[model samples]
Target: MSGEPLPPVKRVVIVGGGTAGWMTAAALSRLTDAGVAVTLIESEEIGTVGVGEATIPSLLDFNRYLGIDEDAFMAATGATFKLGIEFVDWADRGDRYLHPFGIHGRDVHGVKFHQIWLRQSRLAGRMGQVGNVSDYCLANQAAASGRFTRPVPDPAAVLSSFSYAFHFDASLYARFLRGLAEEAGVQRIEGKIVHVDIASDDGCIRAVELADGRRAEGELFIDCSGFRSLLLGDALGVPFTSWQHWLPCDRAVAVPSASTSAPLPYTRATADSAGWRWRIPLQHRVGNGHVYASAFIDDDEATAKILDNLDAPPLDAPRPLRFTAGVRERLWERNCIAIGLAGGFLEPLESTSIHLIQSGITRLMSLFPDTGPAIAERKEYNRLLRQEYEQVRDFVILHYHRTNRTDSDFWNYCRTMAIPTTLEDKIALWRAKGRIIRDQGGLFSDDSWIAVLMGQGLIPQSHDPLADALPIEEAGRFLDHLRDVIARTAAAMPRHIDFIASHCRSDLAA
Candidate 1:
């Protein structure tokens, strides 16, 4: 059975007005051209958790789909380019690695690049020559040297090998997108939702009531209410599934600090005692936050740890955020769909906060329903989003679970704790054959898994046998040539700060 179908979605109401709401509004505003109305409700009194300062390359596609100008968006949001995340002390104290945004090296005869590098490095007398896997990646090289450039479309060019994202002010990004969405005929209502009205016959959300005695009705409802889940959870009675046992860091203290140096073109996730701290470099300030497990450390201690670790003076007192690492059991329940924090939060370990929101919006667009009671659509969306969330969850858990740090109870528990069976299987496969088996349609690429697994010191038991097709001497020469070309190409690129200065400098800090 194809399930029931009702009237087409005419008016779409989005609850909340942070990055999620505006991003949803902006994306759905395109529907207005097809005679669909989009309305967004937000309260000025309730501030947003605006600390999703780092993003992945997928955001570039989201912005492009919305027809946003790259330089203008960057300038408005005080954004700097992001090659990838630099993980510090994840595997153990004093360890560092880059989970870069592009491929490692050119695969020879359909064999994966890492397998070749793995085979060559494991051979006697070639360990020093091959160096770390990071050496073969262009993104890693550029990030290490503070270089930034837009990738070329030419497959032959070394510059085409890597991609980039952004480090921007989340609040400003919301505001920037708000202007676009509003300009595209999206209506905005300023008010707090005091009640959600559910229909009797069907469990679909009928409308949302504001505290100021206003009612906004719509055929379709999107919950971007950030942790509140006003429509989906509160009214529709959808339940949340907690992943805390696997991902235990439940609290975060975030603060903005003055930029001490030129902004680096990447985000930094440094391991802390109770959890981990993030360092995101924007043009104006550095976004710093300590995400720690409250069970092992108090709020005061977490705040102090972040303050003490700052490279520059604080711009504001630390702000605290509380959340469970989980998602709603069903992302789309009935006619009400949840996006962003309202749907779930997997932490910002991989800088996936915004990406998840974008993913939801994209999936919705693809499975966009013209009628009410979109049963098949909802089922597919829930399945896709659930898979995406689990994929990201496993990747995040890998950082915490694969660590060698035993200095604190937090690390000890994380290191010794049992992980999900899915993650276990992935790790086991990697251990067996240096092969990264990524789920189909997963957010992260095989290169991403390779980076984190190898960075955290999880080497495979053996290389792919296909890597042995090429002679050892030939493979060594190929690695040397690739490394030299990447180094020279990276050196030739403009500095990250320089690229921003010439293209998209906000000048807000100055």
Candidate 2:
């Protein structure tokens, strides 16, 4: 290694201009104290795939990091609160479950709360007084009752265990972030990139030549070019590893519908014959989509199904999207780093798309390199990003693979398909006992795993042995008390619509 210190990254060029690009620019511009000049280029003619509207709780961290006010952001995006996702008809035809944003209940006697819940549930089943698992979860109960409230900061409070995200208009969110980015001294260039000029000697990107004969040059390039993967895939020639065999639902038809009633404090995902449909309620309208495998059902049929399922008339014609589920072999290659859809795509089964984007941006910020490329830094960034992608991939796969619905070929394939060894091990452990292996870097926590596993009828054969330390009757009483507390707390909360009106309701005229 050279003894001389490397120069800090002076100029960064971000290609594309949707959520990914703007989020990257806004984050770098605000977070970097070294005064790295950031420039983002995009053409209004090139429309973005703004379908990832529903988000997870981690989005709060992203917003907080950027110093965005919650109420203002919600109003600007026409957002509604999201407590969790309700999976309808997933495990069985009539079965439904809510995967809440928080844990089931507080741990008892140093054992996981879910373990105690399992033990109590088994006992209750024997006594013929089994209760719904969701009853013990504050977020689940609140979502079920169309209630909304900010979580209490004190962990001792019954409502403190829960968290929330948002359902918003993706296009509006991009606009909001763009304003933030531009205000933070980030330059915005409006143009379509005609060509990327590569330095012949080092094979690094030199500049991007726009259609208007203007060349924007930079030392580092961030690719947020959506599925086209402009700089990373086309210019850098990074190979994409397609996971179509595992996640075969490669097409989606999305549309906005008029809101028929007060927006619920959660998202709804109803399983269909060939795939699934999502309903995300926003303040102004509802976002709806059907994600389906083309091999199992044609686009026309999927579109028809989605249209027929809409709660109200569609605001516009259904827009179709095509994608292969997988990530690039390397998210960071040479001097270029790919974020968002350009990096890879896993279907939004659990509303993880935006979170993945946030994770990538955060990781890139953490491993931000100097003006001179560092091979080691690039390798580390790629490794972390790959891990993130794989972890999310496995979690999403669990939803599909751990199913008993064989009414259609798609469902049958998903039910019988082989899964990644990581997921296989996880399933095996859960089946053997109510244990969740925590991944240090994974997005979903143990509580999330437990919720999905139990929701999808993948109940463990027995509770964790540690849970047996407590008497069976004691555990049952504890669960009953917890469920009652959650129910009463949720019942006393303000209605979701009323909460929005009181705090973050949007003035469309503004």
Query: What are the per-model C-alpha RMSD values against the true structure?
Result: 1.7, 1.9
Any runs in candidate 1 off by more than 4 Å, and if so which? 1-5
lDDT of each: 0.92, 0.89
Best by TM-score: 1
- Candidate 1 lDDT, tens digit per residue, 210-257? 998999999899999998888888888888999999999999999999
Q: RMSD, model 1, all Cα superposed?
A: 1.7
- Cα deviation of 125 in candidate 1 (Å)? 1.9
Q: How far is candidate 2 from the true structure (C-alpha RMSD, Å)?
A: 1.9
Best by lDDT: 1
List the lowest-lDDT window of 10 residues for candidate 2. 1-10
lDDT of 1 at 67: 88
Overlapping backbone residue pairs in candidate 1 total 0
Report the lDDT of model 2 for residue 22: 88
Q: How much is the lDDT of residue 129 in candidate 1?
A: 84
